[model samples]
Target: MKIGLIGSGDVGQALAHGFTSEGHDVKIGTRSPRENLVSYSDASSFGEIVVIATPWSGTKAAIDAAVAGNFKDKTVIDVTNPLVMRENGPPELALGHTDSGGEQVQRWLPGAHVIKAFNIVGNAFMYKPEFPHGPPTMFIAGNEGDAKVAVTRILTSFGWETIDIGGIEGARLLEPMCILWVLTGVRSGNWNQAFRMLRK
Candidate 1:
């Protein structure tokens, strides 16, 4: 499948390369295509699936740049964290409790199938994450069942086990795990670890 990535940052680039390595056609969208990325509008229309990997703060702008109607019924992946900078420290979720970035994306692209994933781990561990412990779990959610299934297959191809925690609102639960991930990194100076769920 052709995958269009809406952000050219670390997360976007990492996943683009990962998918390309797996023989999927990938295009990255950014302000600078001279830097080997495509313009946002092109990307939104370029792929079978589009991934929103822009930083939380830049999400709206990225979405606007992506040609509003181009996303209709397309599979849109949300890999962004709503991390708002806090004074004297790291960031916290800007939209949560009652709403989340994922929900906002759904609102922004009302016709798109917005599935959230890959927001819980560092980009370094996103693709083919192999730790001594075991395969990590990727939690995903979306209103579109077929879309989530496709994303689950993508996650598995990227070397992750997955848990579909239900509809888009499930992001309320999944996004917080990102906070814990960042806190663990800051506190331990280790950003290499990924989350895993064990069941007997």
Candidate 2:
């Protein structure tokens, strides 16, 4: 599988590494990319699946630059949280309740099958996370059932137990969970924690 990463930040790089470990070819898209990196358009056109990991603020621009049509019919994994940085404390969600980053990304790439994922945990735990208990749960949301299934397979490869919460609107709930994750880390000074769903 050819995977295109829309951002070259920590999250993108971590996911790229994970995908490569799973035997998928990966390309990272960014402005002013270095030797191995490629432009957003080039990466998007080359990938079978496109992963959007850009920061919330720059996400729209990245999509525009990537040529939205290049993502037509492609499964797009959205790993962004609508966060606004705060000088006083942890970042705050820029939008919620009615709107979310995942929905926004879907709107940006109307031709793409967009799935919301990987925004609830830190980048360090994104791939092959190890926990004393067991593999943590990753909640994903997307309108298309098949697209969610595809992302679930990728999550399983990356060592996560996945739960499809519902349509992209579920991002309204998942995005806020990211702030909770960050707040917990800020309070405890531990970035190793991840969310798990208990079942019997």
TM-score result, candidate 2: 0.98
Put down candidate 1 lDDT per residue, 1-200, tens digits, no spaces: 99999998899989998999899999899977765788999999998999999988889999999977989989999998998888877788897888988999999999999999999999998999998887899999899999999999999999999999999998998889999998999999988889999889
The candidate maximizing TM-score is: 2
Instruction: Please identify model 2 stretches exceeding 4 Å from their true place.
Output: none
In terms of lDDT, model 1 sits at 0.92
What lDDT score belongs to each candidate, Candidate 1 first? 0.92, 0.94
User: How would you encode candidate 2's per-residue C-alpha lDDT over 48-91 as one tens digit per residue?
Assistant: 99999998999999999999999999999999999999999999
Overlapping backbone residue pairs in candidate 1 total 0
**lDDT minimum window of 10 residues, candidate 1:** 29-38
Candidate 1 segments exceeding 4 Å error? none
